[model samples]
Target: MEITAEEMKKSIEKIYERLDEVSPVDFDCGKLCGEVCCKDLEGEGELALYLLPGEELMYEESDEFELYYIDSSEIKYPHSWKGQIYLVKCVNPPRCDRSIRPIQCRTFPLIPHITKNGEFHLIFDETEFPYECPIVRDHIKLNHDFLKVTYEIWMKLITNPLVYDLIDMDSRMRDNRKTNYEIVV
Candidate 1:
């Protein structure tokens, strides 16, 4: 079932509602690593974040993000994906509205996976990142509530086929890379 733009707006908002109050730790995790993850956006045309399919409904040209669209043919995308994918570069980082942070920003240092058998798992993000996230690098202990909410959000998000395919593709890539990261939950 393809999610409509209105439905996607509601779903993304629901995710925001659950994650708005939590952080990986009680304090600013960025300070521990000098905000490396957020600071990476400072470079000229160097950093952009990909929004999941249908997530573009949540933003507009006047928002804090400068949006760009790339043809799927020009980048590596899931076999199931077609046309262009929207990428957003944050105009302000490490200081945006915490409640409306993109899903990628909200779920940092953790990645979601659904096994072939349909079981869900949360793992320390195995994707290659441009900057070192201390939380993942040092195996930081995340707040239990943060972990729970993030896991729950991803589980819900994957019900959309496009999201599921995207996660599955990344999960397969991670498997091919043979990362030995431990599952968070």
Candidate 2:
């Protein structure tokens, strides 16, 4: 069954609260990478992040972010995903309200992975970006608490079938390609 908007909102809020103080490093890692992850690539390309199913409930039309929707058929989303997919871009990069950052931002660097054998693991996100993230490129050790809480949050998230399908689809693609990744947990 699809998760109701109310359920999704509560889950997202709890996730935000849990991740409020946890970060990949003790200090702001953004300083090291010049906040490349948050840069507003105005003319380069659309610098946007995809919102998880029902995550749009947490956002509204605002000056802080430009929100747009794409039909799932137009993207590489899992077949189970239908309807519109929400994408958001910050108007002012690296300066938006950190507390309300999307789950993609909150879980950056480490992506949740489910193995062919059904093993859940956390690995450095290997998605190519226009700029390099120092933390991922340098193999910097993430804070223990950050990893732990992120893992916990993902575990809870995947309980929703839609989230599970998305993660599993990505995992299967990685397996099919024999992609090598460093497992953090």
Candidate 3:
């Protein structure tokens, strides 16, 4: 990994600080959809959350997760991504401690995007998720603070070249396919 463990630790801490302050909405979004996003839906394979490059450092001591290492070359990843990345599955999704959830969990329903002009924005995650998210499905208004902080953290995260390439590659693909993701900010 190009990022040192120390850098990953610092980034994890900073991201948590920003996201811990707000949620997608004032109420529990899960209540509306029975925590669907956190579970394995009816025929879809088991849900797995892929950690961002270097994000595995945050779970070095945690035993609550099942981690799988996948070679980027063997999978569909950004061309810039070489070597492997971590894919984490929470053993007990609904009951896992929210305070220690992974970065992917915290950023759900919102995804990072970088425009061709080199700008950062947040959008409703339009990927083929196993379960539906009411917030995205219903066009619910997210907490403004949540949008602001998530965008800010993503801007910082994209400073890492691999991270930038990953988001940029996804953004370009989405554009090419003309997926209409709502621009939240």
- Please report the candidate that would top lDDT against the real structure: 2
Ranked by lDDT, the better of candidates 1 and 3 is 3
**Which candidate would rank higher by TM-score, 1 or 3?**
3
Write the candidate numbers in order of decreasing TM-score: 2, 3, 1
lDDT of 1 by residue, 7-64 (tens): 8788778877788878889888878878766654434446778998766766763366
- With a 3 Å backbone cut-off (N, CA, C), the pairs that clash in candidate 3 are none
Which candidate, 2 or 3, has the higher lDDT?
2
Clashes of each: 0, 0, 0
lDDT of each: 0.78, 0.87, 0.81
Per-residue error at 162 for model 2, in Å? 0.7
* Candidate 3 lDDT tens digits, 33-113: 998877766688778888887777766776776778889888878888888878878777776667667776787789998
Clashing pairs in 2: none
Instruction: Tell me the TM-score of each prediction against the true structure.
Output: 0.88, 0.93, 0.92
lDDT of 2 by residue, 1-185 (tens): 76677887887888889988698898988889788889865567968889887777777746687778999999999988999989988878878777778998998999989998888999999887888888888999999999999999899889878889999999988888888999999
The C-alpha RMSD of each candidate to the native structure, in angstroms, is: 2.2, 1.7, 1.9
